[model samples]
Every structure is written in structure tokens, then in C-alpha cells.
Target: MLIKPVQDMLLHNADHYLIPADIVAVVQADNNLYHAFLVLTKIKYSKIPVLDNDGHFEGLISLPLITEQMLGFDHLNTEILMHMHVSDVMETHVKTVQAVSDVEATLHLMINDPFVPVVDADGIFQGIITRREFMKSFNFLTHEIGKQYDMIEKDFSSSEKTN
Candidate 1:
């Protein structure tokens, strides 16, 4: 049976690969660093998006980002977390993609990030397109292509033997 055309295989929009915003775990920008750390630990995620009170995508916060501030010459200053905010150390200037963006572009961006955050024109947090999701689709596409190639080779071999 035929599958999707090669050009169509990987060109789907970012929304096609989205892990929607509602299901995503997010920490508020104004949340204290300690709370952010707790959330990351509880969720067991390396990083999570940060949102503002208006629900705009601010950036991402991670355990490492939280701990970085505590590193000192003699000991970790864990006390800093209580006084700081997620915005104090969260990574801003993250690369993002639009929902209308092509999967090819999102895949390229994912090479540098575990997930590419999605946003609207107004910077509203839409969701994320994760490398895991992209790879699932990519693996399926390649597997289907390989199957077609094997079938073609088998047909060619049969035709040659008949001659």
C-alpha cells in the first residue's frame, strides 16, 4: 500500500507535533526559585516553561538553572532559592517556533533543544514540539520508505529472473 508522498512526510505544521499547552507543566515567572525547583523535581523534568501572570511565555526554568546560583567556592548557597524568583535565573531568549511553522524547521531547532516552545504572534504560550514526537514521525516515514525500497528490489529481482 502507498504511504504519504516523501515531500508530504515531514512537512507537516508544528501543530501536528504539538504536546498542547494544557497538558504541559509550567511554572509561573513570579514563582520563587524554591517553588520552581520543587516543581521540576516533582515532575522529574530537566526543564519546564515559565509563564507570566498574563500567560505569556517568559522562558524556561530547570534544576540546573536553579542550582547554578547556589554554587560557591566552599558550599552551595541553597538559601538563595528562597529569596529569588524563577525569572531571576530562568533562561530567556529561547528559540521558539510558530504553530504554522513547518515540521522541518521545528526539527532543525530541536537539534539544539529537547523541545521547541511554540508561541502565537503575540507571544502567548501555545505548547511545545518535542524531539521525541518528531522522531516518532520521522522513524515511521523512514521505515515506510525502506519497505517500499525493499519491495521494489524484490520486483526487480523477480523480473530479471523471468528474463
Candidate 2:
């Protein structure tokens, strides 16, 4: 019996997360305007949750939002710094992915919304894996089974030694 490879499906769906770093934006309340600008400059594709040291997904700082805030704040003496905390801005109750889910579920997620948050089962924030990255990684898997074989070999060799 032939098992269908999920990697094929993931690769086909890579376009869902085609967002580039050019579009990604990160912001935290602790970050100054300058720092937020730098983060925007670095990750230009999507808006990432502003994370606390404890790894909670805080507020998001996208370029468009920052620009609007900048315009609103230009005439005021109030510090833009006051708005830097992500907890004040990030969308709470972010949708997330479970690692054990199949490609069909992931595709449905991406199709419904491209910005699903990827998290561990425990709800810890892992790196956000975009639909594009997921597809790319799966495509890479399509090329060869060498890595899987190597891992299997290593496990067998270790087991033999132990025995």
C-alpha cells in the first residue's frame, strides 16, 4: 500500500504564506519609535506579535498602523513610547496550529486566514511558520529521504551499541 506524502500538499499551498521579511513587522511597548522602525525595516512582510521575554504574544506593530499613529502623534507632546507595549495592541486569542495536524487541516487554515499563529500544544510560542515556509520546507522534503534515513541509521546504531 502506498502512503500519500503530505509534503506534496504543503508545497502546493506555499503561496498562502508568501509574505517576505520586507512585509513582516514587530513591535513591543518597550521598543522606541526608532526600534519599532528598525523592526519594520527588517521584517517587511507580515506583522508578528510583539513578544514579552516570557514568550507571550503581545501587540502587533504593522507599518500601516505605525504610520497612522505617527501622523496622529505629530502634533501632541504625549510620548509615542507609551503606545509601544504590544499587550496594548496585539490581537489576543490568536488562532494557532498544532504540530500533529495533517496538511489538509493546515491548508484549510491558510485558506480561511493566512495569519494563523503556529504554537506548541502547550500554547508556547514557537516561530511563526508561514504558509509559504511550510510549503517550502515540505517541498524540500520531496527531494530526498536522506535525512530521514540518516536519522534512522543513527538510532539503529545507538540501539545496537546499547544492546
Candidate 3:
């Protein structure tokens, strides 16, 4: 199928796909690893956004990072790492997308992340667009296309009978 129509649909309905920041759980860079870990565990999120003191987006902290850091300490008690700051373990180089970004671009960005953080032009953290949300939209589109195709087939059959 042609991509233009899908692109148009995404562009027109872009706002519906966004998850606003208020609902997203974020961790502060200065927060201790224990606090960040608690947030991740309580939310059941594999990764969470890291925000600086000014509430600007900093990076992402994931379980893998915590695990990697814990592994480095060897015999040191895991609790020791908890006292460390999330800034020490969180990935600083993060990828973010503007709220106005097209679905195609967002999808591409999501290939490397569970969710892509949305930001305003001024770099203010907004919400995130999760892969789950994108799949839901895709499924709806395909279902609608199937219904349209069925209608066309029915119309074609009725015309043939009249002829």
C-alpha cells in the first residue's frame, strides 16, 4: 500500500498518540540509585526518564545499567550501589523527539527505545510515545482498511448481479 495516506493520517491525528508528561514517571539525576530503582520497580517500567534539577530532560536510566554497575563491584554488597546517584549510572546520551515529529520519524526512533521522550521546541520535557501505543494505532488502521475492502467487494458483486 502507498505510504502517503498513512503518513497523512498520522500527521492529522498526531496529538492523539502522545502520552503527556504528567502521567509519565520520571527520576531526578540527583536521586539516589535506591530511589530510582524503587521508582522503576513500583512502576514496572524497564526504563525511566532522568530529569535535572531544573526539570529539563537529562537521559534515561534502565535496569541494565544498574545491573552492569552492580556487576562491576564483584563481592561488594549490592546495597553499596544504592547509595550512588542515578547520574553516575544513567545514560547521558539520549535520543529525544519533538512533539510535532511525524509518525514515521517517531517509529524509526522507537526502534532503539521502548518509548521516545517528546519535547517542545525549547527542549522542555513533555511525555513519551510508547511502542504499545503505536501498535494500537497500526492495528486500528489495518482493521479499517479491511472493512473498506470488504465494502468494495460487496459493491462489485452487487453490480455484477445487476448486469
Best by TM-score: 1
Clashing pairs in 1: none
What's the lDDT for residue 49 in model 1? 99
- Per-residue accuracy of model 3 over 94-149 as CA lDDT, tens digit each: 87888645677788887877788887777778888988887777777766655534
Comparing 1 and 3 on TM-score, the stronger one: 1
Q: Model 3, residue 55: what's the lDDT?
A: 69
lDDT string for model 1 (90-151, tens) is 99989888773456567678888999899988999989988888887777777776654444
Can you tell me which runs of candidate 3 are displaced by over 4 Å? 72-76, 146-163
Candidate 3 lDDT for residue 157: 57
lDDT of each: 0.82, 0.53, 0.78
TM-scores, all models, native as reference: 0.81, 0.53, 0.79
Question: Deviation in angstroms for 47 in model 3?
Answer: 0.4
Runs with alpha carbons beyond 4 Å of true place in candidate 2: 1-34, 73-83, 100-102, 112-115, 135-163
